[model samples]
Target chain A: MFRETTVNTALVAILVAVPLVAQAAGEPFIITLATKVAIFAMAGVGLNIALGYGGLVSFGHAAFFGIGGYAAGILASHAQSYTPLMTWPFAIGGTQQMLIIWPVALAASGIAALVIGALSLRTSGVYFIMITLAFAQMVFYFAVSWPAYGGEDGLPIYVRDKFPGLNTLDPLQFFAVAFACFLLAVLVSVVLSRSRFGLALQGARQNVERVRAVGIDPYRLRLVAFVISGMITGLAGALYADLNRFVSPSMLSWQTSGEIMVFVILGGVGRHFGPLAGAALFILLEHELGSVSEYWQFLLGLLLLLVVLFAHGGLIGVLTRRPHRD
Target chain B: MTDPVLEIRKLTKRFGALTVSDGIDFDLRPGEIHALIGPNGAGKSTLIKQICGELHPDAGAILFSGRDLAGEGSVARARRGLARTFQVSSVAPEFTALQNVVLAVQGASGATFRFLRPALGDAALTGPARAFMERVGLSGRENVPASILSHGERRRLELAMALAMEPRVFLLDEPMAGLGPEGSQEMTAILSDLRHEAPILLVEHDMDAVFTLADRISVLVYGRIIATGTVDEIRANAEVQSAYLGDDA
Candidate 1:
């Protein structure tokens, strides 16, 4: 079921890993860069779930991304502050635990997506896009106003956080953890896209009235997918906050949402590895552009506009020129 | 003998100043080829849309197998052993011929949600899809994408998609819309064979093909079924003669 297309795998691998290895040297940078790739890929994978296979153009994933970051940052800050977020029947202090934080981030994002998708699904065409963006903005402003986690100033993770055996301070171990999560997310996407619901989702996108005629409620299926997409994207956000050891209102901004989308479309819309390739290219461009000149953003913008106008299929589409089944 | 598979009574539709369906009534029996023919704007497509639940008639009751279908949507109607192929053949352009058929099969095979099985290239779908394509003369082109298919080939692919549902009744809208004489001949032969197993409501502008294959002809004029009779009776009807046949003459 899972077939990787034959390309210059070694070349792509070296291109991705070597620079990372060099910058990483002995410690932090390697781990941080690997984490960046893994986390961003996870976010891109989330976008692919809705946009690629499902054909939903959600322009507001930063809400989920920021939500994930807040989930980790808030919990860690609570633990650091020596104050329990809440207590059950008795009293319990907050703990910065991945086991707990992951589920919270997932559920929070899922629940938010459920509400957003439920309402957003009502409109089609340009209206649906605007509504989704509006909902994300609403949450973004709410995060900005809330004083919790240092408000606009942001909260710092005093500790690198804890995993079962991996040292939080060691870069490569942390990268490995993020990489495992990225792989799992990819596997989940592969499974879900081929799943029965996934087929209905794709069908619904291609022909909504047709699928409804077949006796399945397309709204319900799409909403669930949207929620799952948000949950996964939110998880990426949590990892991102941990990666930077900082969480702020900037994470929840519209620009962040726009950037994630740019990454997805730049790779190849709906292609499995499209997101990974897109994220890698984006990071490289950012680095190269930044080093080349201060106004590197102008070059990045020029490059992206060219890609969109000339290359309809993005990077993978440019490379393969043929459709490959994920 | 029993209730007809589909029953339409007093179906009516109007658009602003014009009436698209003027109080139409019809019945479709199992294993019958009911030909609905008329010149353009006769509302044949409109009536088909109403029956398939894509349009809501202004006044009417459509009962399929004795169950009311007034409130049902197109997809719901499709699930009730009713299927339709649009005049334009609304298909995913990116999908291959086999994948297109499998998508139809996916809806009917109790597996539309199995996103994990890699159904596109798998034999689970490919085997039956191949057989269906062979049935429709598309066996040789399974690997090709639907967009690149010849017009006749795409028409054949559309039939394969509709038949993949194993529908009780099919609402085919101009299945031979753009075929050449040879292509029309092939389509006519295919329809002749199809009428044996599946009841078909064929809306065709091709008079020769229509007169040859239709078991019963329902002649429409300006949103009205002016006449319904066997081919011999229809050929003799003065109104059908002046309105349609005479024009062709």
Candidate 2:
């Protein structure tokens, strides 16, 4: 069997090569699809931190993702219309810069995570999952009902947000930006997995009693992980909004949460590059199978069942034939 | 003699109509293996839980050193140098033996928020972690995952984790519960030497090991201490013998 590191390197190389090849071939649609994979993979990476490492099976990560999307959409829209987001409390204005947008998105999602995680983490196992789903539903309904930013119709950015040097309008350039964020998310996952906090978080997941016995509050550890996870996913959501130039209430839906989780489970929960593999596979299947049949999701469901039943570690597990290790 | 490291004053806990711990007073000295021996379902586990802040006693003050531990949670108690090993080995099964010790070391160091630096490679954590593993006679098996380690090895790993904390007191709940004769003897020897590092509140069923290792024995029955004395005194006490030791004595 190939070493996991070798497999991980190959995965990263493939992801990078696919986009470049598409760009070179003048297949802008393929580049866009690849960019979507990267953004979705980044979101999966965020969920993996809390779900895989911290054992917090959050079912409402869509709340953070949508919050991030809205952050970008609201900001860019405000900037375009030359309207301040808020006139009071020191006058917070919206910006079209990716740099500013990313932070705002991250902060928004992070705060939402802190609130949701604080309440959701008070319950464990099934209850935790349910509460998270409930919170995401709340966010989804709020997005749908609110008229400020298109509500159920969703909000759109007239133009893509600006990065420091890149032409955000170009598909290939946007792919590069999305891919960088994806790689950074992967790096953060790797660093976190090997760090002290990662150890405690993993330990808490494995045995909450033991973690407490070791003098670390598992709740606090989980809460912190949830916040970081939210921020990463939120950043991805911001990028995703830029890629589509739109933010919708659907992003906050429970289906989005389930899809993000599917990426993690399909790729390999806890594996550093699991999300990337899962996201790529998901996007590839959607593109290929969508052309073959309208019921592509049914085939996807069958594949997910197979992965869960046979490959407990997901795609990475199948490739490596080993369980995930810190 | 030297002002008990842990002093429990009239600790009482009642679950509905059942009193699991009834005004129990206990003390663990600074350098003695104070063994609390009792029969099955005699609330030995409940008393241990109360001391470790897992189960809050309805009444009584648990003083660690000189400060009262009333509202402090188990995590806080553990952080204050009160380490414990579970009856069933509770080390993180997915973690390597070395990683388990490293976690304990990290917990002891009070810097769990440190991210970016790899924990396994850090000299500060691994160095002491390695020493603890070595001290527990698991030097060669440091990299072995805890899940696959032999039952005895898992016990040692738990001990290594506890030792990594450099605790003030070791709340060892049945450390020899599942061990074979040889494993028990090995654990007995390790624990006999462990008292010098910190005092121990041993809750065990193995009488032979208890008699061999305990500096003082406290016989608990029906949620109360019936006898608290040296090994010889405990062996001679008729109430303790009839209540718990019985045919074993």
Query: Which runs of model 1 end up more than 4 angstroms from their true locations?
Result: A1-4, A87-93, A203-217, A323-326, B121-124, B247-249
lDDT of 2 at B35: 96
DockQ (Cα-based) for each candidate:
0.45, 0.88
Stretches of model 2 off by over 4 angstroms after superposition: none
**Worst lDDT 10-window in candidate 1 chain A:** A1-10
Would candidate 1 be rated incorrect, acceptable, medium or high by CAPRI criteria?
Answer: acceptable
**Predicted structure with the largest TM-score when compared to the true one:** 2
Clashing residue pairs in candidate 2 (N, C-alpha, C atoms within 3 angstroms): none
In model 2, the number of clashes is 0
Candidate 1 docks with a DockQ of 0.45
lDDT of each: 0.81, 0.93
Location of the lowest summed lDDT over 10 successive residues in candidate 2 chain A:
A317-326
